[model samples]
Target: MSRFYEIDPTPENYWRAIILFGRNTASYKFALAKALLELHGNGKSQVKLEELAVPYAKHLAQHIKQQPKQITSKRSSFLEQITAYNQGQLDHDGLIQQTTRLGFNNVIDAFHKVHGNDVGSRFFIDQRRSHGGIELTDNLNHLLEQLSAEDLAGEVEARWRLVEEAWANNLSRQLMLVEYEEHDQQLIGIHSQRRISLTSARPALNGYQKGRCFYCYREISILYGSDTPADVDHFFPHKLKRCDDGKPIDGVANLVLACTDCNRGAQGKFDQIPALPLLERLHTRNEYLISSHHPLRETLIAQTGASREKRQDYLQDAYNCATVFTGSWQKWQPRAEGVAVF
Candidate 1:
């Protein structure tokens, strides 16, 4: 069993063999194993029959060859069960063996057999969750290193950089068009008809405040620029005709963090970020920051601030604008009906 699943993770030099040549030829496993044996380990131990990488008896012509669709998920019984064992979730393998998810068993086994025990191979396994339960915990760090040398990373980073450079040239002109809240120490200078190319800003939105979502606690994705990452939000409603322009706050002052849902969403952006009572104060202080809900005004000031008076109100308002939706350190939970997915 160890022979089928185990791979030596030590001896970093062995990894380069697979990392480099595997992209061009079907001889990837042989080339990698030979490199390991020759440069680092015993040369005499090379895989003799190309048994390591070749899943079928036939030799593959290329590295990126479309795997033959001829092989179906149906397996020859015990072959399927053994796969369950290596996946680490050996516990669930038995339970799922006869279920509709059976194809999962065969696929997992074949996957583990080919990929060995390395973390990168887990992504190819039949089931999304393997018998061996832990995935990203064990997978990400290991695989990232392997992929570091892969061609794809270089291409994505390079393409993204060009787009970014083009955007920077347009930033100053764009900033001039925005409208901000006319208040002391506002978080961001707001904008009007401020449009950013989401494609170029994709990296910043996800990478903007770090690897996390600015408001919600989801991990930012590289692809998120297509629509998932955070966005610029208005501190005050632009619709009430209170503000002269439509752009949300622009600079660090009026700007706070927000997820895509809250920005495009119909809920009052500023009101949702601030605690309910404090929102009332913002509404009263500036018509631009007006809180339409009169009934909730006093209550917001009472619970969210340090004291019932003016001094505490200033502190709370400042805190609300600066750190309100930005950090995950303090979690926010909106009360909801009995059942909810988020």
Candidate 2:
């Protein structure tokens, strides 16, 4: 398996990597994702740019209503056209016409690039030169075999929301600090005295881990409808929260998604200090979070350390403290062997 799909080499993982790990210069990738899922549902293999523009522009328009700034760039004509359409300044036909001409400049070529590398699988073929739009590939159809269209689409939306919310909140200023709520297992954005519930910790964090349990690397779901939704686990056991001089154990750096069997089953690592190797994985995961654009990057930097070496020492110190409290053990092993997806 390639590094991108190391958890399980499936069509679904490839698709998830595209949505989860692709760089978001603008939210157009997400708009294209929403359009692809909608078009796929209608059973169209070949779609013209005009047909693609309708859903693509519509998704952008909807998002502009919620959050005006969709791109990191200072200005975007395509987004402005959508904003105009929402304001009744541009008609539907005008919006679609402009979208077909301006909206798909880069997303079609960049969709499959994950972490600066193109994934081995292709979800759509860009036929804009001769065919006018795109040709949905069999890989996309096989993805439906692995996961339902609704769930896959929800993952895209969740990731889009997470990034846009962080963008809107200006990362450098620390406008809002993200905090974990243990009672509900939700991440809250604190601004001054007001507390806003950002999103459920599962969907926000699931994509970075590539839809697998952090320990076992088994396939997991953030969908509430799934038979076994993964658990939002504390990487260091929650019981060790008091040992770190009151440093919050529930921060994004210390929380990971885990399968129920590995989290609380008979052979679970509940309240136990995980083997030392897992601490290195936690460090890697946190660095990945820092590399991403989400406010969780700021939260992790604040909770752990600003630099990589400091963060490494932070985890090392925490592990030493936890080992003193709860005796160290290397007995726990994941139910399956899987490579690191990140």
Candidate 3:
């Protein structure tokens, strides 16, 4: 059975749910929650809804402006809408319309409202209330305390990066701008004036993985430019399992740097549990990420749960879930034989 099965609806679990399942514009809600948790600190501080809006809007604007242009359609995204609202391009009613269109009203309802009763009842007080503010739940505040301020900030930034990458990749696929060719498993994408490129995390990941493809263990070039020839692969194929909330497992823990051949070779191999050897490599890679002070460590712990035993259990559960779709584990052998072992 999946570890996620029979999970209790505790505050920590609720926070994890948001991390695992929230996607696209809904990701801003999680960012808002984290910011609120940080700002409120230890006590039960009731913060005004308007007070939360400033930081949330700022985050949304920064993310929107920084995203790759190709991934962004001509039509403005919710992030752009939020940015516009913050920049005074939109009136209060215009902001409301954009937020509603982006489905943020549902996100707010989900966070503030209790499990049952009116879904949108009140997780936090609405603007209609005399106080018109949100009170941080004790459980949430406690959860936030598990990480230091630096760690919390790093975690939030990492999550934002993953969300941005995931959206861009998905948009490229949806628009039929990205295609996978069978020959050499090559990926072809419509190149715009500016191509989507990896950030500093690429070098960090390359160093951590010893400048080798995570799947094939072949040495990959470490060129640091837009035309650099390495592929950032989703270790767990995004197409395998559809998330009800539209979020895929695009967290750093689920990403690996690969060569063009390995990435293309594994195309559409969704819901297939990699060989035990690959899984072992992945665990080691995660350990390297944790020890190297990467923000991904926090995300890995959050998804798999803390403690080594829990992490192993979570991975086993993930493999089990994959088997349901794939019928059996799929082992990928390195195409290039006699590659230097790390």
Candidate 4:
């Protein structure tokens, strides 16, 4: 019966067979790998997989059931021979023959004869990410219960050990890619029109009234559908350009929460800088940009054709341009009539 499949029918490990007979489509590849990981994590039980695995999972249920038992014999079915095979009981060729002698070579012949190395490499990456804790998590164990279990022996066991050691290397998924942090509050409040929109003069609206394009204010979804008020902005972006390997800059030093309209309109009109969706979420409540900070303002000035002194002048300019001629400051605002240099 074991001859019908390889010792490691782990569809995960059998690439050649998969490539020869199966169309290696992306969806197929991902689905298979995901299924394999799900199975391994669940301790290989089909009865538990009804919901996520659906009908196909049910079909594989029996095959998964019988396979594990065969490999995990209750009384160590081929005990003495397994002992000899495990303890360097034979030469390399002899070990190969040991399978024939034990009448189990058929289970592995497919593995030895598959398509290419792609399957092996992918399976290896997956294995590296499924460590003890990653697989043993509450959600994961429940997930595992749905798939059939495998006897964690031989190559599987050895590979698992190596994976555990290299577990930290697998961080992309573990590092949950979220646009905003939990502390990020969506700012979507209707402020009274009387609020001095720094074009109304505080440090806020100086950029546009002074000639630089005022960037768009952002309105990020706090809980997925909330909008925020517009904050002041500088459409021409400025910041420390990140290195090729560096992550997106999320520090307060890097972002200025702007109003939604401003953000949408700014759309990389100037230098390439990422938008701060977090602050935008909070903007629905208030039109505050990094409106209260110094660095964001300083960076903005620096990005303009400002010399260091000019940048410093604005950063500490006791008389903010927006506040200069209160009438002009109050009246000067960003109009689309400006040049569309973008």
- Which parts of model 4 have CA positions greater than 4 angstroms off? 1-224, 227-255, 258-302, 305-309, 315-319, 327-342
Best by lDDT: 2
Task: Report lDDT (Cα) of residue 309, candidate 1.
Answer: 60
Question: Order of all candidates by TM-score, from best down to worst?
Answer: 2, 3, 1, 4
Q: In model 1, what is the error at residue 321, expressed in angstroms?
A: 10
Q: Estimate each model's TM-score.
A: 0.25, 0.83, 0.43, 0.17
lDDT of 4 at 284: 18
TM-score of predicted structure 4:
0.17
Each candidate structure's count of clashing pairs: 31, 0, 3, 47
Per-residue lDDT for 1-342 in model 3, tens only? 112112344444344334433333445555565566556653556766555555555556566667633123455476667667657798766654555456344456555423232321123544424665556555555655542343334344544554455456553333212222323332233233333333334433443443467776666654534332456676656554542222225555666777776677545223445677677777766654444221344445655567777877766666556556556655555554224333
All candidates' lDDT scores? 0.30, 0.81, 0.50, 0.27
Candidate 1's displacement at residue 91, Å, is 58
Candidate 3: residue 213 Cα off by (Å): 22
- True-vs-predicted CA distance for residue 2, candidate 4, Å: 60
* lDDT against true structure, model 4: 0.27
**Residue 76 local lDDT, model 4:** 38
Q: What value of lDDT does candidate 2 attain over all alpha carbons?
A: 0.81
**Residue lDDT tens for model 1, 35-78:** 22222222222232222222211121121132221122333343
